[model samples]
Each structure stands twice: as C-alpha cells, then as structure tokens.
Target: MATFGVLVFPGSNCDHDAYHALKHVMNSEVKFLWHKDTDLSGIDFLIVPGGFSYGDYLRSGAIARFSPVMQEVVRFAEKGGPVMGICNGFQILLEAGLIPGAMMHNEKLQFVCKNVYIRTESTDSIYTSGLEKGQILDIPVSHGEGNYFIEQDGLKSLQDNDQILFRYCNEQGELTEEANFNGSVDHIAGIVNKQRNVLGMMPHPERAMEKLLGSEDGKPIFESILNSLSVA
Candidate 1:
C-alpha cells in the first residue's frame, strides 16, 4: 500500500477527513504531518487538505505558506514527489509557487458550499490516471476564494501542456456559464504542475469518497495515486 501523509495546520479542519478517507475508507496507510514538522521520511504521497490555514489571515494560505513543513513540501514537489492540495490547500500551493494561477474571491463575492459537477479535462497525470478523460465527478466545493485566475499566456501554456485536469461542468458534462460555480477562468476547477506530479484543486475529493456522503467519485483520485506508485 502507498503511504500517505496529510498535513495538519492550525486551521486545517479537513486534515482528519483526508486521514479517514485514506486510512479507513481507502484502506491505505496514512500519517499526519504537523505544520511544524520538516521531515517527510517514508511518506509516499502528501495531501494538503481544505481549511482556513492560518485562519485565512492576510489572504488564504498566505501565512501558512511559510510554515516549516511547507518548505519541505516545496522541495518534495520539486523532486517529482506526488502532492495534492485541496481547497485552502490549493491556496497554499499557489502561494508556494508549486502551482500556477491565483485564487480570487468568488465572483459572487460570497462563500460557497455545495456539491458540483466537474469533468476530467485530462488523464495524463497520476491523479487522473485511473479515470478516463472527460469523466464527470460529483464533488463538493466549499470555499470563499476559489475563483482561479491566470494571465493569458499562462492559460495558453496550461492548455498547450495539458495541465488542466478538471473543469466545472453541468451534470451532462457540459461546460456552461451557470455551471461555473466560482467563475474560474475557463471553468477550471483543478490543475497539475508542469511535471504533473503536483495537483491543486478546490473540490473536496476526500469528502466524496463514500457514496453515503453523497458520491464515491472521489475514490478514483486516491486509487489512481496509489496504483501509480505501486506500478513505479
């Protein structure tokens, strides 16, 4: 089994949720990596879960970016280690420069919490390897600042490199303005780094691991990561 490390920050409420999903639901070994911890020994994968790190002070993830463990996370990612950031974690990745683009307040200027549909834009990354491109996942997104923005050139690069992994979509997997829950550019919901080893997304895949919790669409993401490492 692949070993997973879930980072825990002071305001990281979803760390436990990620732990439960990987350790219990997915039946994988899981550990908690404290924010102050700089070591990542024996960890096969790292997950930065959703929550207001540093209480979202001075902007979401702005303070948490300098956490002791984050330094290691950046290094780990640079070395081609698999890393994922969800919701507030996504913000942290942006601040860490591990992922491209910036997150802005939802265009509606309000906090959003609800289930949404997202279509897999590419399966080239380990995170989406177990799924087919264009697959639609029913996941929940809860955040105040999830509107992803980037310069036109960066957008072109993402498009050219197939870095876009997921995009908000309607139930039928259609990209529509009404389905753009957060007004993200190109309805983007998730993306991978240039190396495709790091990913940042706003949806709570951990919260969707169980069908009883709403949907099991998130399970494939974990399975894909585990399966990829096992192959390697």
Candidate 2:
C-alpha cells in the first residue's frame, strides 16, 4: 500500500481534512508530518494542505517556505516524488520554487468561498491521469489570494510542456471569463511541474471527496494517485 504524508505547519487547519480524505475515504495509510521533521522516509505521496501557515505573515506562504520540513519536501520533489499542494499550500509551492508562477490577491479583493467549475486540461500527470480532458469538476475554493500569475515566457513554457492541469470553466465545460473566480492567468485552476510529478492548485479537493458535501468529483484526483502506485 502507498503511504501518504500530509505536512502539518503551525497554522494549518486543513491537515485533518486531507488526512480523513486519504485515510478513511481512500483507505490509504496516512500520517501527519510535523513542520520540524526532516525525514520523509517511507512516504510515497506528500501533501502540503491548505491553511494560513505561520499566520500568513508577510505573504500567504512566504514564512511557511522556510519551514524545516520544506527542505525535505523540496528534495523529495526534485527526485520526481509525487507532491501536491492545495490552496495556501499552492502558495507555498510557489514560494519554495517547486512550481512556476505566483499567487496574488483576488481580483475582486474579497475572499471567495463557493463551488466553482473547472475543466480538466491535461491527464498526463499522476494527479489527473484518471480524468478525461474537458471533464468538468465541481470543486470548492476558499481563499483571499488565489490568483495565479506567471510571465509570458513562463506561460509559453507551461503551454508548450502541457503542464496546465485545469482551467476555470462553466458547468457545460466551456471556458469563460465569468467563470474565473480569482482571475488566474488564462483562467488556470491547476498546474503541474515540468516533470509532472508536482501539482499546485487553489481549489480544495479534500472538501469534495464525498457525495454528502454536494460532489464526489474530487475522488478521482486521489484515486489517480492510488491507482498509479498500485501499478508501480
């Protein structure tokens, strides 16, 4: 069985949500890895979950980037280990330079907390391998700074390498400006690293893992990781 690790920082509130989703919902072995730990031994998949780490001081993930465990997370991702960052976790990945682009305050300057539709852009990575292109998913996003930004050159690189994983879209799976909740560049909702092993997104998949929450679309994201490990 694949062992999953969810990193826990001082201000992390969603760590347990991720733990429950992976441990009980997905039946995977899961553990909370403290921020001070340096070892990532026996962890096959790592998650940097959402929250206002370090009280979001200076910036959303600026302080959390220097956490002791992040060094190991960086080293693990450098070796192509599967790592996922959601919401503020995405901010951390950007701050740590594990993925491209930066996050900024929402265009509307308000915290967005609602279900948004996203279209799958690529299934070539472990996180989306079980999803089909253009499939619409109802995922909830709650954040004050979720706007994703990148330079033109880097944007071209991402497009050229097919690193984009999801885009904001309508319920019918049509991309539209009105569907952009936080004004991310090119309506991007999620993206993977060049190696396709690391993924960062602002939506909360762990919040949508069950039907009782209104949607189960998030299951395939975790399911994909489990499926990949079983095959390996």
Candidate 3:
C-alpha cells in the first residue's frame, strides 16, 4: 500500500476528515504526523489538511510554516515528492513558499461556503490525473481567505506554464466572474507547482468524498494521488 502522511498541526480541524477520506476511498495507509516532527522519509506523498492552525492567529498559515514538519515538506518537494494543500492548507503552502502567489482576504470580505463548480484545466498534476480536461467537479468550499492573488507577470507565467490545474465556473461549467468564490485572479481555483507535483486549492476535496456531505467529487482527487503512487 502507498504510505501517505497527513500533517497534523494544532487547531487543524480537517485532519480526521482527510484521514478517513483518503484511507477509506484510496485504501491506502494514512498516517498522521505531528507538525513538529522532522523526518518524512518512506512516505510516498504528503497532504496538508485544512483548519485554523495556530488558531490562525498571526495570519492563516504564517506561523505554521515555521513548524518543524514544514522544513521536511519543503525538502520533500525539492526532491520531487508530491505534496498538496487544501483550504487553509493552501495558505500554508503559500506561506511556506512551496507555490507561487499568495492567498488574501476575500474581495467581498465575507466567509463563503457552498458547493463550488471547478473545471479541470490541467491533468498534468499527480492529483488531477483522473479528471478530464474541462470537466466540471462540484466541491464544497468553506473559508474566509481564498482569493488567490499574483502579479500580472506572475499570473502570465503560471498560465504559460500550465500551472493552473482547475478554474472556478458556474453550473453550466462556464467560467464566469461571479462564480469566482474568492475573486481569484483569472478565476483560477487550483494550481500546482512548477514541477506539477505540489498542488494547492481552496476547495475541500475531502469534504466532498461522501454523498451524505452533499457531494462525492472529492474522491477522484484522493484517488488520483493514490493511483499515481501505486503506479510509481
């Protein structure tokens, strides 16, 4: 079985959700490691789950980036290991300097929670392999600061590199301005690192793993990573 490590930080509310979703849906061995731990060898992949780390005190993920575990996460990413962040996890990745751009407060200045429709923009990522290009997936989102921001040149570089893996859209799967939950630039909802292994997105794919939760689109994402690891 593929060994997956989920980082656990103080105030992380989504660790169990991610553990259950990945363990059950992927049938993979999921281990929870404290944010203060250093070594991460033997783990095939890493996931930074969502929640208010450090009570989100000094910025969403600012303090957590300094955690002992993140040092290893940064090293792992440099070694080509697949890493991912979701919701607050995304903020951490930004603060960790794992991916380009930064997450800021919602342009509307309100916490948005709903089933967001995101179209798969790229499948080159290890996490989006099961998704077809242009396919629409309904994922639930709950966060206050998810507005993905980047300078114009940086945005162009990301687009030119195909780093954008998913884009927010409407019910018809049409990219619209209003459907942009956090006013992310260019409607980008998800993105991967230059190596295409590190992924960050605002939508909670774990939360959508069960029908009882109002959606099941999250399964494919976890499956994608697991499948990739299986093949590896």
Candidate order, lDDT descending = 1, 2, 3
The TM-score of predicted model 2 comes to 0.99
Return the lDDT, model 2, position 37.
96
TM-score of 1: 0.99
Alpha-carbon deviation at 225 in model 2, angstroms:
0.7
The TM-scores of all predictions, comma-separated, are: 0.99, 0.99, 0.97
For model 3, where is the 10-residue window of minimal lDDT? 21-30
List residue ranges in candidate 3 displaced over 4 A: none
Model 3 agreement with the true structure over 122-147: per-residue lDDT tens digits: 98878888888988999988999999
Model 2: per-residue Cα lDDT over 98-213, one tens digit each: 99999999999999999999999998988899999888999999999999999999999999999999999989988888899788999999999998999999999999999997
lDDT (0 to 1) per candidate: 0.95, 0.94, 0.90
Off by over 4 Å in 2: none
Model 1 poorest ten-residue lDDT run: 208-217
